[model samples]
Target: MKKIALLSFLMVFLFSCGQQAKKSETKSEDTPKEVVVMSVDQVLEQASDLAEKEIAVKGTVMHVCQQGGQRCFLMGSNEDITIRVEAGEKIGAFSQEQMGSELEITGVLKEVLTDADAHNPGAEHGEAEHEEDAETQDAHKVLAENQAAAERVFFIEGVTVKEL
Candidate 1:
């Protein structure tokens, strides 16, 4: 009789433990994920790791590509860092008026590889080897300046935008 009672108690305790573990697992699954907000510079610095990941960023719109209205450049509060934000299919064009306005944008980070790099992967070395004339040198200097403006250039495929 004592053995039967102990066995029964052990079975009930084991079953309750299993039930608690299942409940905790369910609770974990139901927990909401924390959202991370980043500045334009942080995103630029982490672009290589964050590429293809969705993130929220805040910045001031510095320029919008007026011709297509599909893309805009955003500058952080520091002014030294800039990132490109591209309108998602559903969001449509970004207006010129949006420039100078502070905005919170949520999107996926994407790398934009230039045509030359995309087509001929080895072309970068060839371009670096070419001798530059005075005019070509000036152009190369401008390109280098642009490249130095940010650690890494990335385009955000905007999922949502709100002016702040």
Candidate 2:
């Protein structure tokens, strides 16, 4: 029967066309690309959840603290996530002045989750441990005071310096 043959051919062609359409739809879904801009808390959570995992974060400079004589951003906004900038070794060469201005820093997010050897586990105690909390507290107070004293409103360096 000619009608039967024609109907079979039409059905086969329609089914094949449907499959091709389905394949194209599936291909788009298969590739997953996701980028998220996380707040400090979210960034900290992600850093803790997946240590050494590469991530991107953006925030303004809240405070800059000097630990081990190198400048580090004591970064915060409404929340506090004591994230540090990568050391000079990691960032090549940079200075505290660079941090004085608003910045969009991109680096590995690291957190010291514990300091079991000392009190208040996870408190970053720099290169040496303190004998007691008071002594450590005083030392930090003094160190902070010293840094505060030396703190300048602005720093001029490199080509920015003038011959006045």
Candidate 3:
């Protein structure tokens, strides 16, 4: 009887240890992945898939926001593709001289709708909507122009930038 009890205890302990290891495995899965560095073209190609994920992208600083330096546009190596990088809490702003410089930026990818009401198909485009006043008509025209621009824009919320 004593031997049987010892064997049963060992079996229970072993089973519980196995379950504990499985729990640890699940915890690891819930953890975030390590950051990976990518180029502008690679990021743009997989933009949708990489949304909300932290990544590092290397590009040339094409344009930095002159108003507040809060945002900068990064161009690909070939100069055809561009990705916008926005200053995050850690990154206060980008300097003007950063333009024309190659940089490796680490940040989370973000996407924003340029115009939330982009081409509202359900809304009627009748003259009644724009006939309120001349100002209203001008506003409508501006809104139309804005809508015709990029419907959605993808950018990176920059965290760190390293000139290379």
In order of appearance, the predictions have TM-scores of 0.58, 0.38, 0.58
Better of 1 and 3 by lDDT: 3
> Which tens-of-lDDT digit does each residue in 73-160 have in candidate 1?
8997676678888896867889999999998889899987653224442355474566658996676666656555634447899988
Cα lDDT tens digits, model 2, 1-164, are 99999999999999999999999999999975443544455565555464554454555545544545244443446534545554445444344565544444444444443222123322564557556678767766666665545522211111111111
Residue-pair clashes, model 2? 2
Clash tally, candidates in order: 0, 2, 0
Cα lDDT for residue 105, model 2? 44
C-alpha-based local distance difference test score of model 2: 0.49
RMSD of each: 7.1, 13.1, 5.8
Measured with C-alpha atoms, the lDDT of residue 57 in candidate 3 is 96
**lDDT: worst 10-residue window of model 3:** 113-122
Candidate 1's C-alpha runs over 4 A off are 1-32, 115-152
Most accurate candidate by lDDT: 3
CA error at residue 35 for candidate 2, angstroms: 6.2
How well does candidate 2 score on lDDT at residue 134?
80
